[model samples]
Target: MKSLLFVMIAGLASAAMLVSCGGDGSKASASGPFGEIPSLVSDFETFSDAKRAELQGGGEDNMKKILGEMKAAEEKFKESMNAAFEKVKGKEVVTEIDPELPLKVVTPMKIEDISVSRHLVKLVGELELTATAIGFDSYEPTDAFELDDLVVLSYDNNGKPFAYDGLSKDMGGEPMPAGSKVPVDTHIHIESYNAASMGCLSKILITLKGSELYDQAKAAADALKGK
Candidate 1:
């Protein structure tokens, strides 16, 4: 479950961000240029609150049902996305599901640096994340956040994932005070590689700073989702 936490989170991030970027490209609208995933995030928030309400009401079975429903929603979102891409590019795409690596939305921050080339588009931004202990959920004292790692993601019209190794494989941190937790921050960089296949858009590549403390991880995630 721990390993798959990312996959779940990524689902939320994708659903929310895409919904937010609907055709308008106007921030004031319920959906932006990205599509309808942001609305899903809002719905998830409501669902979370409802789940909590159920727990308070001693509805454990209800909680399980809600979880199942959320999973179904994610699947539906992907299907809808595939269909939409077919309209934009005029082809169907094959998909690969990584059951082990669910993605989570780190923090909702505005992204910039969107660029386009003949057959590709690129963007860079930072991910503002709340840091917790390495193996615990409690926030670490003294060093509560990070703001250094940088990420970069790219997408070509061809469907293939790309991984880039950074100059530093590991990000070192400041000395921790006794009992202090690991520092976490939202300044990570996320690099993505996307392509249009069978007229559908898919993320074929994703690269991020190796450590949770890098400033690039967030940017990469944003680029992937934004595209």
Candidate 2:
């Protein structure tokens, strides 16, 4: 009887260990290349909740502290995402836009080139604005607009679509007059896990400022799902 009881106790202890290792499905397991993403998201959510609660309590010092914490969390999340992307960096992936749904831009712009990778999509182009579009007769060349002002949409090969609100950086070139075309080199970061999948960026939609085509482009992009 003593031996049997010892055996039963050992079996129960083993089961408990298994349960603890598996957890309660509240946190994601660090398995796949992108597995850390879910945990990062959970952490960010927790941080956001804490920030909101602290703000509600209403203290200037607390607000500053929360803001600093928020910035650090954001940077950490970005670094983690970049690390994940680096894993699949040089993989051969198709970056072809759909021929059926050609890019339609009412504004005067030209996309000369597109380079895609796991982490970023770069667009090399030129943009020319009309006097009417700028609401001015003539204006000197300047960095009058940011790449974030444009509307961009991306679709995976499976037709899963993702939308991006600008988020471009390293846009190089001097600004030109309203009627003169200015060279634009814009790099847009891919933040979504779904958007980072292989063969993503199969379709792309880019519209310039003052184009008034966001709603139409969004509807078309959304329709690509399940196709």
Off by over 4 Å in 1: 1-31, 59-61, 81-227
RMSD of 1: 19.7
User: How many clashes in candidate 1?
Assistant: 63
Q: What are the models' TM-scores?
A: 0.26, 0.35
Model 2 misplacement above 4 A: 1-53, 98-152, 156-160, 164-186, 189-217, 220-227
Question: Over the stretch 87-179, how does candidate 2's per-residue lDDT look in tens digits?
Answer: 543322223322222222233222222222234434444344432132222246543443335545544334544444352322344433345
Model 1 lDDT tens row, 100-131: 12222232222222211121212222221233
TM-score of 1: 0.26
